[model samples]
Target: MKRISTLIAVATLALAGSSFAADRPVHLRGEVTAVGAGDFVVTDRKGTKTTIKLPEQAQVLDVSRSSQAAIQENSYLGIAAAPAPQGKVRAMGVMVFPEAARGLNEGHFPWDLGDRGTMTNATVAKVVKKASATELEMRFGGKAQQVVLDKDTVYGQFVPGKRELIVVGAKVLVIGASAADGATAANAVMVGRDGFLPPI
Candidate 1:
């Protein structure tokens, strides 16, 4: 049994693109993009991404994705890639909302995505600040939505257009029981937990 690197790829979401559980050491020869329930995505050196399903019934050996393993790996080399979901057309629709998705969300992790539900085409806005460095907040319509992040804290990286401010501008679907259309919300009322998978 070989081993795979256990790394969480997404931000704070439970079933978006993070670790669910580890049953066996399913090894592949590329950087892992996303880790899910018995599955993971890998991109070769040619910018070609393949999502490999982990073995459940039988053993997976010399685990590589190709018509023929060696030929595919050899042709594509030196390509930078990351792991994403395999066969997931959209991020949170089926992967995080169905049985297979449900099986994944229960994996060993601290993900608390409480089915707070979906928000689509939500406007991205930032909180107004008077200081150079301050906590970031988003204003959607008349409501303000506090930015919840995995880092969870910031010392001084709140410039607009940067990573800090950009996340607030990114579209999202807040996962919790009381799901709302984040696009029409009025103010910064707490909608769900910090657990979210940015739809970007």
Candidate 2:
């Protein structure tokens, strides 16, 4: 009876330990409302505010302006566009995902760009520039879509951002762990340069 009791006690302790395991890192996107000594507050699109703590060596990435020339065949991309006439999508913005982010969010779904906007993550099969806008033929999962782009369309690529770039009124997408004090301790923070948001 004592042996059985000992085994049960060990199993119980293991289960209790599992309950305190840290949560998986998640992404948080919002506009910075405040910046403190080692932390900042951001308000998301839904108006929810979250406090995020930055470690001394927190990784920071800056999203800078890019051009269609940067996009090449077989490049993974995420496009936010609105439906155009004849079943086409007119691109409002394009985000070039790095090779490491390939296959992330790999599908087309409704987005929040226009009245009935859509977001597509795919590989660029072809790119043709017209007199006014550039057209991209993108394919993913054996499906295809035509995305139209123009100079007004924002393009963003991530680069290492200096810590000083973290400031009030800046938009950020942070990947990190949630702390017990209701703040997120960031592993990496991506911010837009020159007032643009990180599209990916």
Candidate 3:
């Protein structure tokens, strides 16, 4: 899969744009402070409080349990991994973004997971398991990222999130369009199950 280079097709948060496009995709990451009938409150990384209005038709998904064995060639993945020598990346956790969310945040960028860590949105070009760990060749656009998944690497998958997952203090990422009502009008929301941060 080719990487979606634009932020609207990749990652975004509280970005400014035209408000007239009802289906314009915006991205947000924050902590859930409240949940009500049709909306939830989020305080972004910058400590700015924003209301995220969820439409009844919105898709809500949770990060469910998964395994490293699920890693395969052609898989679209969001990897929050550590940095290694020679510009390699070491995987601590891997989230297999579903086909529907493929190219949602496509590119290699710095993430807050670790001090020197990075996030890569790409398709698996190859996967090889060695005696000690698994090596992955992930390609995005014209570039490639090398990732090593050790035995202790954790796995996460997107699953349908029950209403209970939207409760207080959950970390979330919302993809939506601007609304005249000030609150972001979301098309989809991904809430991390338990205390897991939405790594994408």
Pick out the ten consecutive residues of candidate 3 with the lowest summed lDDT.
7-16
Worst 10 residues of 2 by lDDT: 8-17
TM-score of each: 0.18, 0.64, 0.62
RMSD of each: 21.6, 12.3, 6.1
- On lDDT, who's better, 2 or 3? 3
Full-model lDDT for every candidate: 0.23, 0.72, 0.72
Provide the lowest-lDDT 10-residue window in model 1. Answer: 154-163
lDDT of 3 at 23: 48
1-200: candidate 1 lDDT, tens digit per residue:
02211111111133332222322112122343454564444443355544444333222111111111121111211111111234111112111121111112122222222233322111224422334322123233355333222222111100011112112222222211111321111001111113222222
Q: After TM-score superposition, what is the CA distance of residue 199 in candidate 3 from its true location, in Å? A: 5.1
Which segments of model 1 are wrong by more than 4 Å? 1-122, 130-132, 140-142, 148-200
Q: For model 3, how does the per-residue alpha-carbon lDDT over 49-162 read when each residue is reduced to its tens digit?
A: 878887776666776657887878998888878888787899877888666666665778766566876778889999988998889999988899999988767777775565
Candidate 2 lDDT, tens digit per residue, 1-200? 32333222221111211323664444677898999999888889999988888988566776777877889889888787888877889888787766665665567877655688788888999988789888889998889998888767877776456778889988887766775655577766778887777764
The residue pairs found clashing in candidate 2 are: none
Deviation in angstroms for 134 in model 3? 1.0
- Give the lDDT of residue 95 in candidate 1: 17
